[model samples]
Target: MGHRARSRTRRNCPSLQEQLVHTTFLEELVFWTVKFEFPQKMVCLLLIMLPDTDYKEALTQAFVLHYSRISMMLERSTDPDTLSNRVVHVSVQLFSNESLAFRMAENLNLLHVMVISLKYMMGKILIQNTLHDADKNFHYVVDCGRQVMKEHCYWPLVSDLNNVLSHRPVAVKFMSDDNLLEMWFTFLAMFQGMNVNQREMTQHVEYEPNTYYAAFSAELEASAYPMWALVSHLIDSSSIDLTKRVLTSCLIALQDWLDAINFTHPHMNDSMQVSFHLPLHRYFSVFMCQAIKHQGLSLQEILPPRDVLTLIMMHPLRVQCFHWFPTFILTITITIISSHLISSHRDMERMSGVTWATISLTPLGISDEFMQPGQRMRD
Candidate 1:
């Protein structure tokens, strides 16, 4: 009787590989499982019971599976857009579980794989956008351009990454320790073509916001939104040291962007010039205001916003930008100046500096009331 019971117990247990495969399968079941409360609870229970090593294995395999699909799609051998999208869709679902997010990001190898994939996809996008076809109809071409920007693999992936980090403080801390923040900053700077010295005259535009030039610029701005969103998450951290570091890196990135713009703007036509109204530029003031209020940290402790503003204004590109991007620069300049003023306000100690600055800047003078509690930015 004892021997028979032992044999049955052994048969009931799954092997390690089976467990890993089951973990991966759960990602696929998210949609169906989420529709019914009991199934979702069961899936969550299984996730909780899974060992760390098996979860990591599942994650690695998931990345490999999606990357392979993406490669095939790019090759035009087979269009597996659905398969590729599962990568992001599954990731977002997985990140909805904080424990899973922690496990996903805690592995340094996983972080590298994720970031490298992001960079690869973005590089492909930049290459595709740089080579425009002039033969296509203007409206049709603009629509196509916008579609590519929206449909590209990088778009959803970066958006998911931003969303994940926004809520997952543990994951953010892990990523920051791995220098993911700096990597993102550097990538954004290059993605803007700030590092490329050569500039070519683009096909000219007849009017603003209606031409291919406008579409192209809008695509650039849209692509940059995630990076600034990540910055917002970082500055919102509780650690003064981390906030200080983020502010400094923010300044460095802006200076690099300014220098590159100054160098390239002169050679480009009005239609092709990079706009200063990108998310990174617009959000810098908010970041500064948040940092100033972080744990009562001083402006001097964080990099001075005035210094960044001075750099932007003093750059030779500024005069040309004022001519071409007046509304863009003026809007951001006012926000930054307002933030600078709010930082010095004695009431800042009593009220949230970010709320104060935001209310003052808004047209109707309404303020965002929700202030998330801060978390440690790093280990």
Candidate 2:
């Protein structure tokens, strides 16, 4: 009887309240599977709960149609609080297609979405470092986040992309520590669009701390242009000048975050007296590495400066050295990569002309020497 009921839910298009009720039951079943030491039960529960491709597509259309219906309902109401209550009460009583919970989510902020993601990380410092919705097991928060943002509002969110829009740091709305973390990661996500759209795939899992890699090699083929259109719209650039403005906006936003983070503030909490320190460069480089590794759509290709590119490429290798090799060995590793990139004139030809100039002008930061007259530039 229990299995038959579950099968019925699978075969039918459940109303919104019914879906949540079923989902809640499934969520509980997962907990019990773990409690009873049934690993396969846990995996089976998760897989079954996921909407298949056709269902996902159908659910997407329903979400947009529901949003329009909601707008009409809100507009007709004389008192919003009373209307919200009536709609919610009726929806629950009837098990209506419009769930009160989904309606309430549209008002949530980006920070709220990120906290959901953090919960799934199991209190680890590192995430699985993925951006695709297909990495559903790894990135559960994104689905919920999308629900909160709503597909209908995706365009509107794009218009307000930058929390900081200028270099002078004008007085802006105060954001809390958690908000700052969301902004940083979301910015990284935008930069890693290529990786999200095109990458080697990971697979369904029996357990997690899931595999970071898998065997599927068929290419995830798509351009980042439409997403780029949203970004270009964010900055209000003319179509011809879109690329330059987008890059400038990103660089400014990066600097803005770096300025906001209180370096002295103890960020990470642990049982021990010591807290894990996130290095200054790692924040930049982690996102940079994701962007750098894109073979299909190289963000690194358009961005200027050979020295910056050199540092971005070396970050992953440096991390490997730090983790897998000794400090002295890491030192030698950096020295070799840096020398080969900078010292060889023939090797420099692969970089743009502007990049070569930037490299030539950079003094390698080795000596405490004074700048030449008129050479010092504004920060």
Candidate 2 C-alpha lDDT tens digits along 232-260:
22232122133333344444443433223
Q: Can you give the lDDT of residue 53 in candidate 2?
A: 49
Provide the clashing-pair count of each candidate structure. 0, 0
Number of the top candidate by TM-score? 1
**Model 1 alpha-carbon miss at residue 364, Å:** 30
Q: Estimate each model's TM-score.
A: 0.53, 0.25
Cα lDDT for residue 143, model 2?
24
Q: lDDT by residue for model 1 over 183-285, one digit each (tens)? A: 5555554333221111232333333332334334443544445435555555444555555555566566766665444432222222222333343454455
After superposition of all CA atoms, the RMSD between model 2 and the true structure is 20.1
Off by over 4 Å in 2: 1-24, 33-38, 45-182, 185-249, 256-362, 365-379
- Count of backbone collisions within predicted model 2: 0
